[model samples]
Target chain A: MQHALILIGVLIAGMGLSVEAGLLGPLGEQVGHLSATLSIFMVGALLLSLALVFTPNRQLGTLFKQPRWLLTGGILGPVYVIVLTLATPLVGVGMTMVGILCGQVAASVAIDHFGWLGSEQRRVDGYRVGALAMILAALWLM
Target chain B: MLLPFIFLILLAGGAVLAAQSSINGRLGAKTGVIESAWLTFIMGAVLTFLLMFFFEPAHEATLFSVPKWQLTGALFGVVYMLAIVFAVPRVGTAAATVAVISGQLLMSLLIDHFGWLDNTVRPLDGSRYLAMVLLIGAIGLIYLSHQQRHRRMVNQPG
Candidate 1:
């Protein structure tokens, strides 16, 4: 049940990310693409700061302590926004999303199996491989 | 034609990287929901800033000249992140993913077709609908695979 919950969480997160992407797409259409990208992250940073301020339990110091990890993870945010923004204008939102999902499945398999960068090691088995294949096939069809 | 495909691939790669970071952030044994969110965004922000440093913008005023309306999109991200943390534990990953994608597809269609969020009106066309259908079908297949695995596990002796 716990495992199932985690999986569901990831999926929901993915979906949320997707919708978030869709909203940004139209916003990008209005603001120049680069400006839109910067604004999104800047706002994201501001939002996080506000959350940290309002939510007393979380320690800002903890985030600062591990600068390397935070930096590495932080870089992904902008890269994701930029690449996704770039992709949308070039290949429409739908195709760019398909491509994004394809990479997600492929990278997820490795990340799960190898436990790279301090991730929890979830062993990849036949079931996972089969699931991956299905996702890939779906991307191809998309 | 090919350029779009290439761009898509790049987008996918970025998404994957983002996913890996999420997993990593959660790996912290004592991390809670808010902490996880904070770490993910903080890390993501730093990376974005660095990239901005190296990649000179085509428009000089890009960083400073953001419009007020774009800020609304940030609220969407916040809501989406919260939904993810809340929904994942209830529905299971595969099912939740399908539901979320389904919602996104439906919403995206409306946005694109109606020109919501200040977009140029691009009438929903056949090709766009076809692409969405394909995406939905793909999400369905993923769910089926998960179900098959679950059934096999249930049938197996502990």
Candidate 2:
């Protein structure tokens, strides 16, 4: 039952990501790149704020006091959006996403194994390495 | 032109690393997704604002001039973040990512091919489908390997 729930969650997340990326292509077409990006982040910020207000889990202080390691991760948020937007114009959304996914999976393996930036380290072995390599090769082929 | 491409690659790499870092932080200690997400956006918005101030004056100027309809992209971001928090643990990162990419490719094809937003036409073609297949296969293989590792760990003596 837990596994099933997880699978459903994965599908929902995937669909959400896809829709977001899809919207980007069109949004970029309508608005200039910077405006599109700023708007998305602004809206995201607004939505998250609203979620915090309505939900009891609002830990604004905890989030503010986050360590440098976690704070560093915040940098990626905007950078990712900007990159995806730029890449869409250059390589098209499909290819750009392929590149991003390749990078992401590759990075995920290391992050999972070593737990860099103050993360909890996990076991690393041949299976993990091989899997990541295969994914990279597949990205290249694709 | 090349600069933007380079920046994009760097940004993608950064985002991946950042995500993993966040997960690691969660595993190591208690972390609130909403709080973390809010901080991330606030910081990101500030950073981008600064970058705009220093680098591209003309582009920055146009940002305020745009109509409200252009802000629709934000709705997508809200959905995407919600999906991440919900899906990452259940499906594993690789599988969940592939699913997202598949959705993106399909949607992008439709939008690009038809110029759905009154933009230039860039029809979907063979290469796109081929890319999707590779991503799916890659994700499947990764998950299979993960299962094997889990089995090995279980079989090992404590």
Candidate 3:
């Protein structure tokens, strides 16, 4: 039951960005993708900062010695918001989602296979490949 | 012709999203998840602030006048990003993503079917349900593969 609750929480949480889709459209129309993207980060950053204040945390300075790539991880979220904002109108939501899913699955598999970007390397075995194929088909079926 | 090209571009955008969990998850391992997320927002905020200037005339007046709920999108970003950072390392990025996507598809289907949030109501039909079932199957396959990999490693000689 506890596991089911967590899974349910994750599901509702997954809707966050999609729910944002409705709001961002008007926001995007008002300000453009760049400005809209800025707004989200600003709001998100503020919220996160407030949350961090209560939590015990590491010093950001230590991150400098770790490697440049770790610090660069911030770019992906803004990039996704910006790209999705721009692409959605051109392709429509359905195609944009399909495209995004395809890209995500492909890139994920590659990232796991190559172990790029500081992740543990996992080989793309036959089952993994087949699973990916099924995902693609399922996406098309959607 | 151009639309197909645009489709491919959108596809690549999706690919970046897939990488997002693992990237942040790894950062979480180093700085702790909350701090990693905090740093990411800081960097991203700086980056987008610069880009915002290039866009010019940034609807500042309109944004303030709009309902407060419209702006709550970023709060969701916080939850989703933090969750990804936490889930990725524990479950493996691939498996964690499958879980995330499952949630996403289900939610999206509801939004589509009921037209929640002022969306146009599109009835959920048989095919969409089938697609979802296939997705579950895909998730199963992915999860099974992870289990097998673990089993194999365990069986290997010390």
Say which candidate scores most in lDDT.
3
**What are the fnat scores of the candidates, in the order listed?**
0.29, 0.39, 0.66
Model 3 Cα lDDT, one tens digit per residue, A1-142: 3333444455566777667766777777775767667777888888888888888655666666677766777887778777787787787878888888878877777887888877787788877777777777767777
**Regions of model 2 farther than 4 Å from truth:** A1-8, A25-31, A81-99, A118-142, B1-29, B59-69, B86-99, B109-131
Query: How do these models rank on TM-score, best leading?
Result: 3, 2, 1
Model 2, position A87, has a per-residue lDDT of 63
lDDT of 2 by residue, A60-137 (tens): 666546555656545776667666665666667546655677677656555555655444444555645554565455
* Regions of model 3 farther than 4 Å from truth: A1-12, B56-61
Poorest lDDT segment (10 consecutive residues) of candidate 3 chain B: B54-63
On lDDT, the stronger of 1 and 2 is: 2
- The alpha-carbon lDDT assigned to residue B137 of candidate 3 equals 74
DockQ of 1: 0.31
Per-residue alpha-carbon lDDT of candidate 1 for residues A2-74, written as tens digits (9 for 90 to 100): 5445444554455455456656655555545545655666676678677777886765556445536533544
Task: Give per-model TM-scores.
Answer: 0.65, 0.71, 0.88
**Least accurate stretch of 10 residues (summed lDDT) in model 1 chain B?**
B87-96
